[model samples]
Target: MADQEETHTNGSGDNQDSPATAKKSGRTSLLDSGEDFEVLDDVDEDVDDDLPPLEDAGGHKKKSSGEEESAQAEGANVTELSAPQEEWLDVLGNGLLKKKVLEPGSGPDSKPQRGQNVTVRLRSSLADGTVVEEEPNLSFTLGDGDVIQALDLTVQLMETGEKALVETDAKYAYGALGSVTPAVPPDTALTLELELLSASDAPDLELMSPAERIQLASQKRERGNVYYQRGDYAFAVNSYSIALQITEASSKVDISPQEEEELLDVKVKCLNNMAAAQLKLDHYDAALRSCVSVLAHQPDNIKALFRKGKVLALQGEYAEAIRILKRALKLEPSSKTIHAELSKLVKKHSEQKGAEQAMYKKMLGNPADSSAQKRQAKTSWGVSWKWLFGATAVAIGGVALSVVIAARN
Candidate 1:
C-alpha cells in the first residue's frame, strides 16, 4: 500500500520552478515536474529462478538433503518426491494473522531482521480467491512502511526460500480505505501467498556497482516523492536523506563520467526536494543545509537558490536571502517565480531593516532628541569658529594701525 502511493518526479530543466512558485501557480510542487527513473526494470531477474515451483493447496513435495546429494552424485534427475504434511501456525497468537508453511526454508536460523531489505514474491487475494495483487519480486526494507503492515510483519517471521500462505485481517492490511488499484472492498481480509526469496542487511554503497547505487538512490527519491505527495513531510525528509547518503557515498566508487553526472543530478534533486519537505516541517536550518548541498553541486540551480533564499528569509537572514534570490534571478532572469520571490524578499528585507532601526531608536531613547543634540553640537562649533575669526580680524586691524603710526613719525 505504501508503494502504491502517488509519486511526483523532479523535472530536468532549471526553469521548472520551485515548490513555492508551484504553490502560487496552483501546481503541486517541483517534484511534480520531472521524469521518474524506471526502477522496476532494475530489480534482480533471478528471484524466481532460485525458488522451487509452488505446489497445490494440499502441500508441497520435498526431498531430504541426503537424497538430493545422492541423486546429484549419481547424475540422476530426481523429479517425484513425497509431499510434506500441511501445518498452519498462528503467527500473532491472536489468529488475526496466520501462516501456513508450504515449503520449509533453508537456513532456518537466518530469518530477516526488522531493518533488513527483503525481496519476496507475493500473491494477495480476497477470501474468495480473487487475486488483488501479484508481485513476482517485490523488494522493500522491513519496518520502512514500503509495503502494508501485514506484509512487513509476516516477512520478518519467514526465512530465505520459505514459501507460506499468510492470512491477514483487514486491520493489518488496508483497513477501511482499502486499496484502489486492486479494488479491495472495505474491511476485507487478505490471503497472501508469500515466497521470501532473499533477505539481507542494507547494501553498503561502497560495495555496490555505480548503476546499482543510482537505482537504489532513485528508488529512495521516488519513495520520498510519494511521501511528499501524501503530506508525510517527516517521512519524506527521511527518504530524501537516505537517497542523499547513497549518492554521496557513490562518489567513492569507480564510475564512468556519465554515471558521475547522473549521480550528481540525482543528488541535486534529492537535496532540493528534501529542502522542500523540511520547509513543510518547519525545519528551517535543515532545509537551508539541504539547499546549500544542492548549490554546492550545481551553483546555478535555480530551485536550490530559490529554496535557500526562502529558508534564509524564514530564518530572518534577510540579507543573505536577498543575495541568494538575486543569484537565482540572474540564472533565470525571466522567471516570474524568481522575480516574485525576489520582490517579496526585497520588501521583507526592507521591512525587517526598518523594524530593527526602530527597535534601536527605541532602545537608545527618542531619535528626535538625538537629532536635536546633533544640531546643537553643530551650532556650538559654528559659534566658536565665528568668535575666533572676529578675534583674528581685530588683531590684524590693530597691527596695521601701529605700522601706519610708525611710518608717520
Candidate 2:
C-alpha cells in the first residue's frame, strides 16, 4: 500500500518537499514527486560478462585443487559460537532489549534462516495497553526489513510454535519520527506478542531460469514499493537492493537478448527506487551514484535527472542543480512537480547569491575605508624599519669615532 502523500507543516521532516523525507528533520529526499518512470531504449545488457558465476544453493562449481584447498583452509578459520545457554539474549548486539525465551522449543535447526519467509501472528500495543496494531497473520522474509528490526531479530532466534514477548524501547520501535499512519507515535515504547506460525525457504535463485529470476525481482520491487509508501526507507532500500541483485544475477545467466532487456529495465527501476530510499536516509553520495548509473543507460530519464538535481540542490550546488533541473523541465514541461522544484532551486540560487554579496560587502566595507586601513598599516611598518636602520648606522659611526680619538691620544 502506498502511503498517501501528505504535506508536512511541522517542520520536523526532510526540508525538501519531495514525496519522501528522511528519518531526521531538515534533510533532503530523492523520491520523485509522484510520477511514472521514463522508460529508456534498449542497451547492451551483457555489461558484467567478466564477473564470476554466482554460487548455487548446493555450492560453487569445483575449482582447481589449490583453490579448493584454500577455500577449505579459510572455512577452517571460522569458529562457530555455541548456542546460548543463558535464557536472555541480545539479538542486535546493542543493549536495546534482552529477549528471554518465554517457552523454549526445538533448537536452532527448527529456526528460520535469512531469505526464508516466516509467517507470524502479531499483536502490538503500548505499555499502557493502548493497541497500536494487530494482525492475525503477517509474513516477511527473515533479515528483510518488512518487520521492525527488533522483531526480525527476535523471531529468528525462536522456533516454530514458539511465542515470545519482545520488549523494546521507543528508539528501536519508532525512533524520533513515527510511522506514516501515526499509529506508533514518536518515541513510544512497545510490547509485541509474536507467535511464529511457520518458516520456509524462498525459491533458490541460482536454480531458477532467467524468466523466474525476473519474476522474483519484480515481486521484490513491489514489496519495496509497499515499504517505501509506509515511509520505512531503510526497509525499502533493502527490498530494492535484493531486487537489484536478483536482476543483475539474472543478466549473468544464459538468456536471450529480449529477456536481458526486460531484466535491465527492471534493474533500472530498482536503481531509481533505491536512489529514493538512499535520499531519505541522507545518503547523498549513494543516491548520486544510482542516478549516474540510470543516466548511463537512459540519458533522457526524467526521474534520474530530477533526482540528481535534487541531490545537488541539497549539497548546496545550486548552479549545477538548476542546470540539471532545467534540463529535466524541458523533458517534462507541464509537470508541476518538476516545475515547482525548479522554482525552489532558482529561489535558492538567488538567495545564495544575495548572501554571498552581503558577506563580501561586510568583509570589504566601504572601498575608501579598506584602502585607508591597508595604506596606514603599510606606512607604519615601513617607517619603523627605516628608523631602526638609521639608529644602528649612527651608533656604529659613533663607536668608530671614539676608537679613532682614543688612538690619537
Candidate 3:
C-alpha cells in the first residue's frame, strides 16, 4: 500500500482524557496566515508540564538514549526522540506559530513547492509538553490537506534531511473541533519535531531524455509490481499508468531507432501489466482499454489477447471472449494460461446458456411440456375426470330423491 499520512499523538496525553480535564468550547481555527483565535479558559489549567516529557502512545515508555541503542542492538523497535535545542522563531510574520531548526538540510537549496510529495518522520505534542502524535515516517504532498495546515506549511520551509521543531498555537492545531483522534482535545496547541526524509518533484515526461524517461517508467512499473504484490491493486493500477504515460510521452521525443524501439516495448509491457492490475481491481473497461492498447502495437501478444478475453468474459460477453481466447490459443497453443482462461470462458458460456433456457421456460411455461405437464399437474391435485364424474352422479341421485318427495307431498 502507498504510505499514507497517519495521525499519531505522542506522550502520556495520547490516551483517554482525564476526568480532571474540562472540555473547551469555541470556534476552532487552524493557525494559517496568522489568523486570530479565541483564547480558551482551560489552556493554562490543563497544561501541566513545564517542558513536556515525550511518551509513546504505542504503550511503550520513552527510553533513555543509551537504553534505546541497547534495545536496538537486541533487535527491539526503538522510538527515537529529538531534543529541543534552539529557540523558536515565528514561521509567519505574525507570532501565531514558531519553528526551531535542530539540523539544517541539504538539497536543491530551496524549500519544497506545493503539491510536491514530501516524506518525513515527525512527533507532535501540545504546548504544555504532551505528545499528540509521533509518526516514525509518513509521506504526503504539500497542500493536499492530508496533514494539518500547520505541518503542511511547516514542511514548505523544510529541505531534505532537515530536522526542526514546529510550534503552533491552539488556533492552528485542531482548532476547536480537534482532530478525528479522540485523544486530541479541543482548543489545543501542537508542537511537532519533524525530519524531512525525502522530497521529489512530480514526474514530467517532456523534460526527461528517452533513456531517463524509460528508466523512470520502469521504476514506476516496479513500484506498481510491489503494490500489486501487497494486494494494493488500485495503487498498482496508478503506478502502471504512470509508466505508460512516461513511455507515451517519450515516443514524441527525438531519439535513436533503438531507443524508440525500447520505448515501444516498454509501453507495451506497461499496458499489459496495467491491464492485469486493472482486472484484479475489477476495472473492466480500463483493463480492456489497456489490453487494446497493447494489441494495437503487437496484435499477436498472447498476454494482451488473453487479458482482453478475460475482461470480456467478466463483462458477460462470452461469445466475444471465446473468439478472442481462441485467437490467443492459436498463436500459443501450449500456453496454460490461455488454455485455462478459454476453459473458464467456455464454462461461463455454458452456464449462461443454461440459465437463459431456464428463465425462458419459467416465463413462457415450456411449450414442449405444456400438454403432458398440464395432465400430470391435474392428476397430482386429484382434478381428473373420474372425480368430476363421481360428483355428477351424486348430484343426479340427490335431485331424483328430492323430486320424488315433492310429488308424494
Candidate 4:
C-alpha cells in the first residue's frame, strides 16, 4: 500500500491552495491527487507473493555470495553512519525511528540475478547486535504474488518520498523464516537493515537533465515504466520501445559498452515484458518465440527460462517445462518461488506418468475408464480388488455375526 504523504504548510499560513504546495510534497502528497505509483521511479511490491525468498526454508535471508561483512559495526545514529555513504543516501529519523535510502533499480522488472535492481536497503538492528545477512534491493516492482510479506510491510512504511527502517519481527522477514541459517525454523525474531534508494521514477533523471536530447526518451521510459507496473505489458512494451529508439538516436552521449550493458538490460526487459504480456494474453506460440529470442541474446537469463517453461507447459510439453525450470533453479538455487514451481511441475509429471500407465493397463485389459477390472490392476494407486471389497464392506457381511448371535441366544 502507498503511504499518505503530509505537506508542510508554508509560513504566513495564507490560503495555500496552490499546486506548488502539492508538488513540493513530492509524489507522496500527489498520490492523494490520484497519481499512479507505478509511473513514479519507485516501484511498490505487490501484497500476495508472500513466500520465503529462498528454497532452503532455513528461516533466513539467503546471503549473496558476492557480498561479505563490511568493517562497519555496531549501530550508529541513522544519520551519523558515514558522510560519503550519506551522499548516496537521504535519511529520515526521529530519535530511534528512522528511514534511510538504500539502492535503486532499472525501469524494467527482470530476474533478481541479471541486472541491478532498484533497492531500498533498510536497517533496524539492535544497537549492540550485528545484521546477520545482507539485504537485497527492493526498488523493483512489488505487488501481489511477487515478494515476501515482510518486505511488503517494510515498503509500505514509506510514502512515495518517505523512507524508514521499520523494526519488524521474523514474522515480517521471510514470513516466519527468520534467519538465513537453514538450521533455524521460521518465526524466530530478527532485525533488518533497510534503506530507501529513491522515492520516484526519476532514476535516470540525473543523467537525463545533463543531456537535453534524451528528455523525451526519459519521459517515454517513465510512461512505459508506469504501464509495466499496472501489469499492462503491451503498453509498457510500447513505452519502452519508443524509449529504445530515442536512445539509439542519442548515441552522441559518450557511454562505454559497460554502461550500454544496462541499456541492453532494459531492452531485454522490454522484450521479455512484451512476451510476458503476450503470454498472459494466451499467445503461447508468440510467447515461446519471444522468450527464445530473449534467450538468444541472454542464454543464461532466468526470466526467459521461466517464461519459456510456462510456454512449454501450456503446450503440454511437461518434460521441456521441467527442464527449463531446472536450469533457472541452477542460476538462483536459493529461490523459493522457483523451487515451489518446480515442485508443482514434478508432482504433475508424476501423476501424469501414473495415469498413462493406468491407461495402458486398461487398454490391455479391454476395460472402460470406470471399469472395476482396471481398478484391481494396481496402477500405482494400488486400489486392488481386495481393497475395493474392504472399502465397500463386500466381505464378511453382518449376516454371519447375526447367525452366531442367534445361536448364542
| Total clashing pairs in model 1 | 2
Worst 10 residues of 4 by lDDT: 8-17
Question: Which pairs in model 2 have colliding backbones?
Answer: none
Model 3 TM-score, 2 decimals: 0.50
Q: What's the ranking of the predictions by TM-score, best on top?
A: 1, 2, 3, 4
TM-score: which is higher, 1 or 3?
A: 1
TM-scores of the candidates are 0.60, 0.55, 0.50, 0.36
Candidate 4: regions farther than 4 A off: 1-221, 244-256, 366-409
Alpha-carbon shift of residue 61 in model 3 (angstroms): 36
| Candidate 1 Cα errors over 4 Å, as ranges | 1-108, 114-117, 125-130, 141-145, 161-193, 200-204, 250-254, 369-409
State the displacement of the C-alpha of residue 278, model 4, in Å, after optimal TM-score superposition.
2.1
- RMSD, every candidate, angstroms: 15.5, 19.4, 20.2, 26.4
**Cα lDDT of all candidates, in order?**
0.73, 0.71, 0.67, 0.50
Error of 2 at 201 (Å): 4.0
lDDT of 3: 0.67
What is candidate 4's lDDT per residue for 298-378, written digit by digit as tens? 998776787788789778899989999999999979766567778888899899999998989877875565576556555
In candidate 3, where is summed lDDT lowest over 10 consecutive residues?
1-10
